[model samples]
Target: MASLDDLPLRADLVGRTPYGAPQLDVPVRLNVNENAFPIADVVADDVVAAVREAIAGVHRYPDREFTELREAFAGYLGHGLDASSIWAANGSNEVLQHVLQAFGGPGRTLLSFSPTYSMYPLLAQGVGSAYVAAPRAADHTLDAATVTAAIEEHDPDVVFLCAPNNPTGTAMGLDVVEAACDAARGMVLVDEAYAEFAHDRSQTALSLLGRHERLLVSRTMSKAFAYAGVRVGYLAADPAVIDALRLVRLPYHLSALTQAAALAALRHAPTMLARVDELRAQRDRIVAELGRMGFSPFPSDANFVLFGGVADPHAAFEGMLADGVLVRDVGIPGTLRVTAGTPEETDAFLASVARLAPSPRP
Candidate 1:
């Protein structure tokens, strides 16, 4: 067998590992920020029926445009959006990869904040673009001034703004989005994969789409929709931005079954999202309880909470895993991130923490 070192791998990727969390076969899995709730059976049945119906057309390639699915997504999003402004792929990750392919490459640079989505750098590098991890505020927040300054300094070809950013679970104000759109000399992508988990839904970067052509807001069904296994992600942006992505996407990239299943799920959008409020409650509970337990939990607006004050994050993670609960050790010293799942999962996580977590650092 040949080793990776012996193969002709790209120099940038030679020593890099794939982006992922530990997928342990534990009884409790709050590690990946997934919607731990099972899909409503009625919705699941509809999805299965849709997929079965779609199987009849599997002999042919799917609709290259995925028109009806885009229309469904538009209706679901409902900020005066239509199919012309929607683009999707296997997941939000691929949707982002398409954006990088269209806008970032060898001579271009991609910029994002540290402790942001771990995949940003890998996606940029895979597209042959230089990646810059800009510094965030002292409290792990990104302010408008910091964003504008980074864009001014790097002159990057692409900028990623992960709203309600990952690992930290810190929400970004739209002011920061406004600053990025104003300051970026190139494409600006707002990753809102966890938007549904936010406390406020009235305003998002999506609201700014009519004004800025470079502004792109991406969304995914993998989180709040309990559709991670279905692999459906889409974005809403200016038609021109959608056009740019169309240029780089593979032919019939989205399979018919996926489109059918996603469309069926969207038809039950209300039912699919019924647990959002409950999940929000769980997230708040984690934040509050962690604070009461002497750990410092950040004010999160997403479906997960990132708490600090662990004496040994690795040990805490290991202990929790051994106790049949799994949380993410996102390489942040003194911090660990866990998804806000069911009430029972929360109970298990808290119990494991009480058993294993060390005293808070004064």
Candidate 2:
């Protein structure tokens, strides 16, 4: 078998690794911050029926515009957005890819704070856009002045903001978002992938949409909706922005089955999200327990918690993995991330932490 080096790979992709987390099968899996609750049976039945109905017409290309799905999303997002301001793709990844392909290319640049989603740079690299990883405040928070300063210094063609940011679950304030939208000379993308898990979900960038035409807020069904496998993600922006994405999107980008299933899921939104409160409880439990155990857990508005102060992040990870538990060792010094799942899952993780990741020495 030929190694990757044997092929004429893109020069920029040389030595670059693909974005992924461990897919290890375990009794309790929390590495990826996935919503651990199963979908309600009612929602599942509807999804199956919807997919079955879609299968009846699979032979035809899906509604290329995904018109109804967009409308459904607009209704779900409810910021006075219509189908015209909506865009979607296979997942948030593809949605971001479309953004890059449309607004980014050879000579353009994408800027974002560091220790973010980890995929921003890859997406930029994929589109031949330069990726800028700027620093955050020491405590992993950002204020308006800091955000605007970075925007001024980079003068990037696109600014990516991951709210309730990954690996460290801090949500960005609307003030900072406003500043970035005001400062960036080009596009501003606020990724709210975990917005539903935030304590105050109402404090979203959606409020700033009408004011900032350049702003785009991206979201996914993977986290709060527990629809990771369904692979539905979308964005809300000015109608003109949607038109730009249309130029770069693949024809029939979303399949009939996808459209149908997502629409069905939207219909039972309240039921589908029934466990969100419990999940939030679990997240808070993780934070409080970690603090009691002398680990410094960051404040999380997402379904996961990123705790630091571990003496050996890998050792703690392996120790937990040994006990049939898995958590993320997101590559920050002394830090590890764990998703808040069911109470049972949280018990297993917290127990594992007590055994392997004891209090660090002062």
Candidate 3:
């Protein structure tokens, strides 16, 4: 029973808390923005076979570079990327960790706009880098001018742009991304963890990669690929960037089973992604329903919607939980976020919230 204070810990982490979201056991779980559908049986069988092959050699360490997985990832991305230009790890969080470890340090700073993925600042701090936040537009938009001006002011060594951003589920325009890259004197990291769920795939920062060596686009199989349980996330960037990441990545960081499973998932990428349209339909339904109910649901390009006008977000969240539907109260006052789950799950959530009859914020 030793307290953290009793041990020698990093001074910066002394007062910080771990990133946590409710993992409640509920009949209708929508707190996290996960793909509601399970992997198809055929694909699941392929995964089983691939993993079985991996197990036969699990006694030894996996390929340190995860060559095959990287190749499969590049093929899936399909922007003429090769294995040398790709890198991956346990999850998108780890991909960010690698970026921070490679480019961030005590004297460097990591900057981003506010109301974005909550983990960016923490990731910077974890790597002993200074963190700075600039407020987004009043309407929760990130325009080129705003991002460029902030880049000039902060002069950070790294910048993080979360497209199809978490919490609010807004996407960054290509203009903003290009401007941010041009303005930054250092690395520009575009986190597209929810890219596959975007309304327009062409808006992704990946299209900017060939033009900017400093640009990096991070993605994950967790959300749209129904591979959250497999924990595979990746990035595409210049080969030099990938080389820098190799320096800090632990030897054999990815397990053989993980590599095998991810490769198998990539093989059946189309099938694994077949549920996206259904999920998008449900997402649109949620937004429209919320609007009709007198709430302000943000227009989302991701699988979840961040709706406002709740009298008390936490109260509404609790009410929903009481009825067995779990959603997130992302600490945005008078706002809450819910994933676009199955039709039945969505119906249950809508019914539960309708029962509460929560009023809009004035």
The Cα error of candidate 2 at residue 199, in Å, is 0.6
The candidate that achieves the highest lDDT relative to the unseen native structure: 2
Cα lDDT of model 1 by residue, 1-362, tens digit: 99989999978888898888888898999999999888899998998999999999899999999999999999988889999999999999999999999999999999999989999999998999999999887678999999999999999999999988987878889899999989998999999999998888765898898889899999999998899998989999999889999899999999999999999999999999999889999999988888878888988888999988888998898889899999998888888999998999999999989765556444
Task: Give lDDT tens digits, candidate 2, residues 1-362.
Answer: 99999999999999998889999989999999898999999999999999999999999999999999999999999989999999999999999999999999999999999888899999999999999999998788878998899989989999999999987999889999999988988999999999999999899999999999999999999887889998999999999999999999989989999999999999999998889999999999999988888888999999999988889998889999999999998899999999998999999999989876565445
Whole-model lDDT for model 3 versus the true structure? 0.91
Off by over 4 Å in 2: 360-362
When summed lDDT is taken over every stretch of 10 residues in candidate 3, the lowest stretch is: 353-362
TM-score of each: 0.98, 0.98, 0.98
Candidate 1 positional error at 228, Å: 0.5
What lDDT score belongs to each candidate, Candidate 1 first?
0.91, 0.93, 0.91
Q: After superposition, how far is residue 41 of candidate 3 from its true place, in Å?
A: 0.9
Model 3: per-residue Cα lDDT over 1-362, one tens digit each? 99988989877788888998888888999998888999999999999999999899999998998998899999989888999999999999999999999999889999999899999988998889999989997668889999999999999999999998887899889999899889999999999999988899878888889999999999999999988888989999999999999999999999999999999989998898889989999999999888877888898999999988888887899899999999998888888899999999999988988875555343
* Candidate 1, residue 352: how far the Cα is off, in Å: 0.9
User: What is the TM-score (0 to 1) of candidate 1?
Assistant: 0.98
